[model samples]
Target chain A: MLKFTCPYCGIEASETELAAGGEAHLKRYGPGSSEQDFEGYLFLRKNPKGVHLERWRHVMGCGKWFLAARHTATLEVFGTYSAQTHEPPAEIIENIRAKFPEWQA
Target chain B: MSDPRSAVGGAVYEGYVTVKDSGAHGMITLRGDHAELAEAVKAAVGSGMPTQRRIEGGLGGGAAWASPDELLLFCDYADAAGALEKARKSLEGNHFLVADVSDARAVFALEGSGIRDLLAKLCPADLSPEALPHGEFRRSHLGQVAAAFWLESEETATVICFRSVAPYVYDLLSEAVKGGPIGIF
Candidate 1:
């Protein structure tokens, strides 16, 4: 089972204690946006083989949500950050870039 | 008002490990800034917040850390209302949430030779003394139900789970010891 560290509680929780929230940092297309933009926002998702960012809630533990960066193929987790932030922190971006130089955060 | 009955009473198993009902206790889920809430909590519950993941005992009862900003205060069910009122008074202007969830959970105590290994079967959290130690609280699961557990001493532990599923958890634990030190619960 995958292990995750909760940014709010500082506990390293097993995957069972956490709930995956699929994809992070999605821009909302509401009200004035084009239909295609709204459709993309609602239905489109990136399923990259390497270096992906996602959201997770510590459901059985602290009940706080957080973000995690991981590789879909290798299962190597880069790091976890607080859910309160609007963007990924610079150090995390740097770590991902170091591993996949062509990738952008 | 009616008194709450114990979810699972009497000893269900007589083996190397024993399980007993701890009865219903007054429980509060308090959340706020730890440093700020510590004083108010001490005034209200007769004990201060435990240092991250620990449990502290005092004249009134015991306080267990549920998370970084949360503390679970447990006392006699009869005294819970009064304790919550006192804590609210002490916490006056702070940004906090104090919820009395006394009936939400049923508590049980497990003690014996292989209780740690038995707990390891059900919970993913490390139960080794060096890692968990005494007085440390961990929130995890007992099968599919959510549970919070802590070590009272070397051979003893207290487990709290949702009231509705207390019997199911007890039965699962009972089945674990029937086969003489099974690998999984």
Candidate 2:
């Protein structure tokens, strides 16, 4: 069982509590998209080791959006934020604030 | 068993709903003398909660210390009822509430790479080990299933809920795995 911290719920999700995301962010267009586009999105993929940004749609609780960055080697999640508002978590605030204080606002 | 009310989704939440008119497992709700029940449960289940929040990054099945007197135990779906009965019969009439819930709820586990990233999308809790850590359990909604989840590590979680709503819960999770937003039912 894995413990997952939901950026939206602000609580730890027991391995039984949450569903896992795809390899980072792999987005596929709806049926409206042409076959080539769908096939390209599904088959072509990249495996990142560090600072990879991905989208995870929480289907269980708050029903919100999130972006997550984690270290593939250490399993250390750098930070997560609500994608709906683009509000990053505090853990990321300090890391980015030092570089761009103006962006903090 | 493919009962009309139960689901053994590939993982815990993958197929969240299960129903059993006759339970294959036993449930023992130990109240009051929660301490004694916990001790017995410890002996029955594998062991107690893990010492470190992050162990090997693969979160294990789930054993937790809820309240001072309350501890929730998880076992094989088939073994749950028997385990509960064993505990109940062992301490008969002891000041505890032991009831067989083997048929009442469905159990599932969600584990894999990017688990935290997936959870951050559904829950509003701190799932990070540094923050929420391990050895914890919370009753919250996973798209309205009103689930109970235990965080074992960075890539594992256990989810259990009423058998009646197992399909909806499983559906929510399935939809998410496909990269769709969760919805309330």
Candidate 3:
């Protein structure tokens, strides 16, 4: 089981204690946006194999939602941060860049 | 109107480990910065936020740190409503959320030499004295259900779960205590 550190509770919660909330930092394409943009917002996803950001809720624990930056292939969690912000933290991006020179966040 | 009965009827199962429904206790979920709510929290529960994952108890009952910004306060049912109101009033004008969850969950008290062993079967927590000493709290899953449990002492633990599944929690505990070679004896 993949263990996730909850940013709010400061606990390394087990997978059962968390709920996956799909990809993070998705821009909403509401009314007035192109149909293509709206459809992409509704259905599109970036299922990258490495260095991914995800939204997870510590439902069984603190009942708070947070974001995590992880390597999908290795399951190595770079870091976790509060969900109140719209973008990933700079340090998280830097860590990813140091490990993966080819990718950009 | 009649007083409410415990969700598990206060059942007591005698085994290597004894599991008892502690009955309906007053449980409140409070969220705010401890630095900002320190005085108000102390006034409400006789204490402030507990030291991370620890529980503190006094005349007003116990308070456990639920998260960095949240605390769970527990007390006798008779004093719950008044304490909540006073706490709310104390923190008036502050950005906070205080919710009374007394009816939302049930408390089960277990004590005995084998209590820790029993927990090993149900939860993934370490449960060792060094890993989870007295007054430690953790929110985890018990089998398939969500539960919040704490080590009140070396030989005692208090588990809180959603009231709707109190029976399930009780049954799971009972089964664990009465099924194995180390348990049923």
Most lDDT-accurate candidate: 3
- Which lDDT tens digits does candidate 3 get at residues B89-117? 98999999998888899889888877778
Instruction: Give one digit per residue, the lDDT tens place, for model 2 in B1-185.
Output: 66433454443323222211222233334444444554555554544432222111121223443333444555566566566766666667677765656677776666665555555565555555555555455556776556666666656665666778877766666666667323221
What digit string (tens of lDDT, one per residue) describes model 1 on residues A1-105? 688778877778888888999999999999999999999999999989888999999989878889999898887888899887888999889888888889886
Error of 3 at A86 (Å): 4.0
Candidate 2's TM-score reads 0.48
Which model scores highest in DockQ? 1
Worst 10 residues of 1 chain A by lDDT: A1-10
lDDT of 3 by residue, A4-97 (tens): 8888867788787789999998999999999999999999999998889999999888789899999998988888998998998998888888
Query: What's the C-alpha lDDT at position B10 in model 1?
Result: 51
How does each model score on lDDT? 0.82, 0.53, 0.83
Q: What is the interface RMSD of candidate 1, in Å?
A: 1.2
Clashes of 3: 0
- Model 1: colliding residue pairs: none
lDDT for each residue of candidate 2 in A1-105, tens digit (9 for 90 to 100): 334556655655554445556544455577899998888787866566544455565545433456765555566555666564444567775664554455422
Worst 10 residues of 3 chain B by lDDT: B176-185
Tell me how far the alpha carbon of residue A49 in candidate 3 is from the true structure, in angstroms, after superposition. Answer: 2.5
